[model samples]
Target chain A: MISMHLTYDAQKVYMKVLEECLKASSIEYELNGWSEVKLKGQPALSEIRTFKNKLREAGIYVIENSRHELIQRTKDTISEMILHQEDLKSPKLSTYLTEKLNYSYTYLSKIFSEHTHYSIEHFVILKKIDYAKKLLLESRLSLTQISYKLGYSSVGHLSKQFKKTTGMTPTAFYNIIQKRNRTL
Target chain B: MIRGFLKLAVVEDDKSSKKLFQKAINESTLVAGMIFFQQSNELLEYIDGPQNHVPDIIFLKLDPMVKNFLKDLRQVRKQHQLRNTLIVIYSSGASEQLIEDTFVYGANVYMDKPHTYEKFREVVEKILKINFQYLESNLNIENFIYRT
Candidate 1:
């Protein structure tokens, strides 16, 4: 669904494309491999291809294909983060991601937003719900158990977010998927 | 120049299909090494990671995730200016829309994951024969172009 994390390779190539896409538009850039701290504005995409070729002429290569790795990495990190938590409600998710990825929240968010067409918060929520859907559909884990597994604070929170994203409550959604499966 | 076994990345989310396909490949006469990854992410990384090691061919197991994956792969191909790699989509999922979309996104071939292992072997044999013929014709074409 829309909630699956952008794979890491896709994220990398995506950010590189975003970086080059911005560079092509004459927007200045900066990076701190450990601490992402600054961003300025939206990119001009009118002459994007021209700049892409120009960058190529300079011998710098951006990822040339799929964003699969990028999304995969992000999900892996999220999964790992949740997997480590003893209490899903009190997860140190933000700290874990920032520390592990070695980028300031601001920079990661900015670059991700520039590349993905979604904000980091929105993306993370999508990922959580996607995982929840997966857990809900694939296994018979109780809602509370799935919530804890997903690092959710409570079943209420999970139900609320699940409803928000899927337009159906978790129980309802699971039932539908179950009925659909039986038919198939 | 170092010559290595041809590398193929097989992307499939399902475990059984992955095993079945790998078994089929192993039993076949193809001179290749197989690296299996369950998700598109690993496949994408193999192509664009720090090594920039694009495989000779990639077989994507078509599913809902594949459509968006192809779209993203297009960006990577464009950014890297890569042409040596061939992407082939295989699925026993049997979705016409998926097959059509894959071709639209530049998949080299879309074939059903054969029902029988022998059928899989036949497909591989045909692919190899075709490539050998293509190589012979390719040399001729280059000679003709140069002469012209």
Candidate 2:
């Protein structure tokens, strides 16, 4: 007999349950990130009530605070920009955020720092580097192509930022990944 | 010939445990120096002072009995200078919720406190050998915890 309890990925389950709740409420929404959902428009209080009730049954609670919601929106926007490569067209991330969120960049950044304990610029760098790692692992793009895709002016610029965020150069990082694959 | 190249800091309060930790860290070839802090505030002050001393890796003892254990973890992460610094949280037997909380709050690694000094040295050496920069980039719940 198999004598063990089955385990499931909590994040996966959370996402599934969230989608079910949204569908049940007939709310049009987009999953911005693992933890954020972007609704098409303002959700009515009754719709929110039902959604909250469904999520509560799954042990998930909606963040009710406006500040927390704003933070999530900011993170979602940043993640979307980086993962989708939407920033390539935008002249500046600050201006893009100001226009999209209708809040001054200064105010958005200050509140973001107050809550997350890191600047928005730092967060963007981290996200971009993370996306770069994904692209590297996929092995579909060259380093120069990745640099251009991430909107870096030059390969040297991308390497500099990558090295700063991660202690090793991109080539070094790729070598480690190769070594790990061989070992496995 | 040149060992002890890695700077380490330990936030531990128990006197006997501190001695054991120091002995294990001293035996590790990768550790060049180690500092012991009986309180988290002392470590924070040391890191935040004008001198700007930041250790490569910090071993934080997570004890529920201790007040502000999670708060101290967050405080350490708040330092911009410590962004690249690795935080290894060790506990005798921490709850699942607490361990998850540590990860969400930016701890790079979670370890179970080893009973034997030999095991402690081994753990220290193994942790130092791993490239934390790569680990940090690919961090997830599956790889967050360290096991011997």
For every candidate, how close is chain A to the native chain A in TM-score?
0.63, 0.61
Q: Best-fitting candidate, measured by lDDT?
A: 2
lDDT of 2 by residue, B1-148 (tens): 1121467889988998988887776665455578999877899889888998888788888888877777778788767877767888888898877775666566666777788888877766666654232222332322222332
Chain B alone, TM-score, model 1 = 0.72
| Top model number, TM-score | 2
All models, DockQ values? 0.02, 0.04
Q: lDDT for each of the candidates?
A: 0.55, 0.72
Across residues A1-184, which tens digit of lDDT does each residue of candidate 1 receive?
5777654675566467556655656656666562241334533343344665665665545453433344335546765665566554475656776877766767666655444434556656655666677766677888899887777779999898877654457765555445434432
Correct interface contacts retained, every candidate: 0.00, 0.00
Per-residue accuracy of model 1 over B1-148 as CA lDDT, tens digit each? 1121345677777787777767766653333567888776666666667887666566666675445766654443343423545556676665655554555455545666677878876775444333222222111211110000
